[model samples]
Target: MKQHFFVLAALCFAACSKEPVLPANIPTDNPALPANSFTTFNIAKGNHYCDKTAVHVFSDSSMSVKVRFDSSCIYKTIDPGNQDDINKLVGFTEGNNNHLHSARFGWRWSDNALRLFAYSYAAGVRSSKEIATLAIGQEAKLRISLLPTEYVFAVDDTVVTLPRALRSGIANGYWQYPYFGGDEVAPHEIIIEIEEI
Candidate 1:
């Protein structure tokens, strides 16, 4: 029957031609990007948390950590609306709560000054950003780039990109740094550096 009328007119010209769907470029900001996109953590343990003492000192590379904060408060302030100590219960999470990706930068204790914070958690949901202001030894360089969903928060040159959810997971996890939660410590006598740049 005339080749089924040219196969029903080529299936009605391929269902009237369809095409429109473009999204996925990634790079929310700070795109002078280079240096392998991000992945550097080698701090040879200099762990010490004050208020009851908690120590884990041992990170060999001369990245010294001996901040025995026995209290003499050289400058420690936090109680502005009382975020229960930087709001996060704030720990760089990894694995189930929903799904995860975490990032954390240092030197935080803001009220009047001394802030250079960057915190993130995805899937279970949480976010924080202070970005700059510090002087206890003044030296900052925080970096995090873990993508397979989204998470890129770099500091000192500032870059914050976020979005997470793809099964919501991070099974390649590891992050712990003088983590003091609920019971605080380290009021002075500082010297913590597990830096790798």
Candidate 2:
């Protein structure tokens, strides 16, 4: 009887303890997106990739999209550096069948903010840079413009530049979708809504 009392007391204490502070501007609930125009990407818990979407060939000078993330975007990584790992946002490969030479916008939740980035690979070499920070539940305009010698990433009003691997030609590759992980799968399910613009 005494042991049961202690266990119940402990449970009560845990339940009444204050919860940790969360980031500001977090959405309390997921918002609906127009199904006809917006494509929802869901990364399941313990998974690295989102549910398969229609595969499409891409050959464009720039890829632009409107992205909205929910409260589920907030997460803690096991490794500090993993927080820096940018998850694929939207992008395409450059050249035919050359994923090693491609460009894309990436995103992650780190430092209590939703951060976007310019991520790419050139001749099998990878590079990434923080482009902008957005709030949860806010729709952000993200675009990656291909240039002769560089790739420009623009998010809303912020612009960041990165070197392009394949210059002087349009990006002719397949489209990339949302993916989670640096070395770890998503700790929980994550949902991202995107619409090409």
CA-lDDT, candidates in order: 0.42, 0.80
| Per-residue lDDT over 146-195 for candidate 1, one digit per residue giving the tens place of the 0 to 100 score | 56766566655777666654433343443335343223443434333333
* Worst lDDT 10-window in candidate 2: 27-36
Query: At residue 81, what lDDT does model 2 achieve?
Result: 77
lDDT of 2 by residue, 79-170 (tens): 77788677787788875443478788888988789988888888877888887888899998888888887888888989988877677657
Candidate 1 lDDT at 151 equals 59
Q: Which stretches of candidate 1 lie over 4 Å from their true place?
A: 1-4, 20-119, 123-129, 133-144, 147-151, 155-197
Clashes within 3 Å, all models in order? 5, 0
Q: State, as a TM-score between 0 and 1, how close model 2 is to the true structure.
A: 0.77
